[model samples]
Target: MRRPLIGIALVAVMGIVVWQWPGSDAVASAGAPRAAIASQPVANHGNWLATPTADGKLTMVAGGQLVIDAELRRLFDFLLTDSAEKPIRQIKDNARKVLAERLAPGAANVAYTLFERYIAYRDALGNVKPAADATPARLADVVGRRNALRRQFFSEEEANGLFGEEERYDRFTLDRMAIEADVSKSAADKRAALEALENALPPALRQARREPVTHLVEADKAAELRAKGASDEDLFRWRSQEFGAAAASRLGELDREQAAWEARLDRFAAERNRIQADASLSAERKQQAILALQNSQFTTQEQLRLDAALALRARQ
Candidate 1:
């Protein structure tokens, strides 16, 4: 079975930082050292250090240098790099050391706990195996399991710090997925489900979700119409209504190009037939003529498509 389209939802949840969490101070303290308000900018390497606020909040210095320690930078590099070949155990160990060195006395443990949960969450997500007949309930169950793990591992404050806006977005996605997977529901019911989900999201995220949903729905409708032998003009109108004038115009150009290509293919087919039927041409001459015709008709990229189309036609 194909993997469910839950990756986007997962990314949305994991990528965001919960700035409003009550325990934000604990996490923030792990960041760069606070600079004094009037501290002179020090040029370290290529970066400039900024003066801290009166309350000791880290601020950018005049130069490009960040106030963060070298160890913190190294830690970030290790985490961000493609470590697919490296052992997970080694990475975790390195991460612990980095956090211990960089974070404040009490903050390091909280940060480390978040890191551990994140890694475990990812591993569990990878292992989820949906049933052959994937239903709304089955898919929801998978999401539920993930949520359960999250709840089990992190407190409300920790979740807020780690997930932030992503938490709501993920719930929104699961609700949307459940609606889509419910084959028992009518089209109207699915539409209602989706609308309700959108309405429930935060204003910014509501708009974000709406655009993709609209694009996908319209694109699917266009494909359906095309399969039913809709004209290019009809498709242009549909696309315009769905995606606005700019996208519609772009698609119209693609349609005209495709029509021109098909016409060229027809001409090539006629010429090839004439060459094949020529009684005066020797077998070697006929082969040479066909090769010459192919070279004249298509460039390398076009030739691949031309070959595939011809092969498909032959099969038909």
Candidate 2:
């Protein structure tokens, strides 16, 4: 043990000394090929287990010096890097393996289902062919444009069409440079808009403009609902899809229904209020008759969601 410790100390000292030398990078490169790994992390060698399974798969945003822009990566360089045949092959093979795994232990029915769908899609395409485009790229050999290339290999597009689409490559080619150009234009526009908005804000509301308004909007709505005698529980119920959701989701149908209801309610309430104010319907009579029937119990959250949806629809 003492000898081993002494040897380790000597090795560490030598390693530091050599690493500090002028030609160390070249030496490290030369040695990289010769080094033997004593162990491998789960992420090594393109293993399926290496990739993490996120709770809900989403297109996550990545940026900075480390991240290459997706539009450029996918639509430009990656599309033309000696063709995508290898990665395509990888996707095909891996997809088949994934299907087999999913259908393991007599899961023939599911496997058949996936395969049938895949084949049917291919059949519908008629004359297109498959390429081995699914294989992942190897980077360490490449030079300065490496990171840009690296970004392409692990791009959103590749991830999107991960499962084998046998006929995809035969029909379409990715135009990465054009895509990158668009991305650059979009980013520039966004930055310009933000800057313009900030300049217009007279230095007072700049911070407020940049911050999230979802919760603030929610609070304002709840307060309004409270003013209308709506209990918190009523709001919660409406938010939890306890109201108006069971109706059909066809926007035209919903619009017509909502319009009719709103028009009827507005006219009815206005007439009722006018009658009540005329001293014809006493407060006691109004309470016992019309007012008692029109109790609107709803959550502020629900109202906020509706307002937001309506705003979006109007914008559209």
TM-scores of the candidates in the order shown? 0.42, 0.19
Global fold similarity of model 1 (TM-score): 0.42
Q: What local lDDT score does residue 140 receive in model 1, on the 0 to 100 scale?
A: 48
Q: Rate the local accuracy (lDDT) of all candidates.
A: 0.52, 0.32
- Tens-digit lDDT track of model 1 for 126-202: 45443223343553464455556656666665555344444465456556766777889999999998888778766
* Residue 259 alpha-carbon offset, candidate 2, angstroms: 1.7
**How much is 47 displaced in model 2, in angstroms?**
34
- Summarize candidate 2's per-residue lDDT along 1-316 as a digit string, tens digits: 0011001111111011111111011112311212110111111112111222211111223321111122211212222233335664554455456434433433433333333343333333322222112111111112112223323433444323331121121111112212233545687775665455446533322322222232345447656866899764555554345223321122224346766656755555565567577677677886665544343422455444544544555586
TM-score of 2: 0.19
Off by over 4 Å in 2: 1-249, 292-316
Which whole-number lDDT from 0 to 100 does residue 259 have in model 1?
77
Per-candidate Cα RMSD to the true structure, in Å, reads 15.5, 25.7
